[model samples]
Target chain A: MFHNDGFHALDRQECLRLLAKVPVGRVVYTRQALPAVLPVNFSLDTDSSVLLRTPASSDLVRAIDGAVVAFEADDFDAVARSGWSVVVTGRATVVTDPAEHERLSRTGPRSWVVTGEGVFVRIESEMVTGREITVPHSTD
Target chain B: MFHNDGFHALDRQECLRLLAKVPVGRVVYTRQALPAVLPVNFSLDTDSSVLLRTPASSDLVRAIDGAVVAFEADDFDAVARSGWSVVVTGRATVVTDPAEHERLSRTGPRSWVVTGEGVFVRIESEMVTGREITVPHSTD
Candidate 1:
């Protein structure tokens, strides 16, 4: 359904489907009690959890472990003035179990940059919301 | 200079230049003490402040007014595995002065959607940082 402002609200299933199509997204987390955002490549686990693989020593892992964060991804066409955006909010936890780590290492997202031993951070898909902007039909 | 992870750090001037090139970005804020992010089209003011125009009664106007917020914009080439991202953190204030509002109405960003009377939110460019990911040269 379209909101009063003309944005179409996307259902949870649709949101998840759209999210899996994109390889990169922005992670929102708190840094020193203020908001910080970083663009990272991510993947969705079978259960729909957002998965990120980064250097175990990266600052992002330190800042977001066990913290409530938001992940957003979108595709926009400036020339066509149409796009869709999805936001997922949930608690992020670092995967520590060696077996799970090994499984994720084999199945999770690959790091865009090669670094030291990699770690996996998972954000539960607790809340998912999305909106789409459609160009109104030309009256002419 | 490249960081240990091979990401090139962008200076302030370069960040602003890049920010202006993108017409849309994500705004990060705190909602119910958790991070929230939304895609917004923005422009840089003469003083380099991030200016967003939204419906005066929009939820974003209420959530970000007089609050610390983060704005981020980036462009990436998935095939080439390269891109740059810039983040700006600062205080967001609603433009209330009638003269300033009028001036911004003429000079600020145009909303992607048409709505009721619009309000202007300016995010000071207090802390700006960015990084660039360059595809590694083929050793072959």
Candidate 2:
């Protein structure tokens, strides 16, 4: 569950539900005390990890050098005055085993960057948190 | 004009048009020699800059502080065997100035992450590149 200051908290199921709606997300990493975030298309692997596809020379490839990373995806609805978001802090790694890549192939995005050296990345969630907002009067 | 290694390259106008159709994209940032990318909903500003709304304390906010960032959005058409993608690489800064924030507010996403310290992070594109792929007939 996610709670901040005084707001509604969301559970794991709710978090995954909202995440399933969006195909793309941002992966956060640090470089020389500087921060950079790049967006990528991903799927939720059976192990409940986030899988992404990209080409070589991508900053994503450069930074993943075997380390835990941060991944996030979100959307909101102003008309309903309500929305939900989820964050997954996990360890990101290149899926080197061909079988794992083949398994990920089932649900990932249909297209690649069209650039060679394409590869897939996976993040195993260490901590998942989420939040929801509701503005009752605004809906009317 | 973005053509590399024998593929169709998309220009600035085409990039904007394509980005308008998708609600998700990845935001990649670097922290201490590591790279990260997250998904976000963004709208194209008048000058074709990337504008996204995020709450305070987001991994994005903390990680993307005054750094070079890459913002990417794409649309894929499977049946047609064609798809296009646009990538904007530039420096990102917090839009703290009230007036600029106001202007961006008009062009920003309809839903805002209702977390504390939500500020607009605008990426001013220094370089924009795009590509498209049309698969050959496999019936042969």
For each candidate, give its TM-score against the true structure: 0.94, 0.60
Put down candidate 2 lDDT per residue, A1-140, tens digits, no spaces.
21332237678878888888886666666645444454455778766788887654455577865777777777755344455667787888887888766765665554333344356887887767777664342210
Report the Cα RMSD per candidate: 2.6, 5.7
List DockQ, one per candidate, in order: 0.52, 0.19
- Give lDDT tens digits, candidate 1, residues B1-140: 22766588999999999999999999999877778898988999999999998777778878899998999999988767789999999999999999999998889987777565588999999999999996572221
Best by DockQ: 1
Candidate 2 stretches greater than 4 Å from native: A1-9, A17-42, A52-65, A72-85, A96-121, A136-140, B1-9, B20-27, B30-42, B52-65, B76-83, B96-121, B136-140
lDDT value, residue B46 of candidate 2: 77
Which candidate tops lDDT?
1
RMSD of 2: 5.7
On residues B35-126, what C-alpha lDDT tens digit does candidate 2 reach at each position?
54555667878787888877655567777868788887766543555567678888888888998877766656643344443678888878
- CA deviation > 4 Å runs, candidate 1: A135-140, B135-140
What TM-score should be assigned to candidate 2?
Answer: 0.60
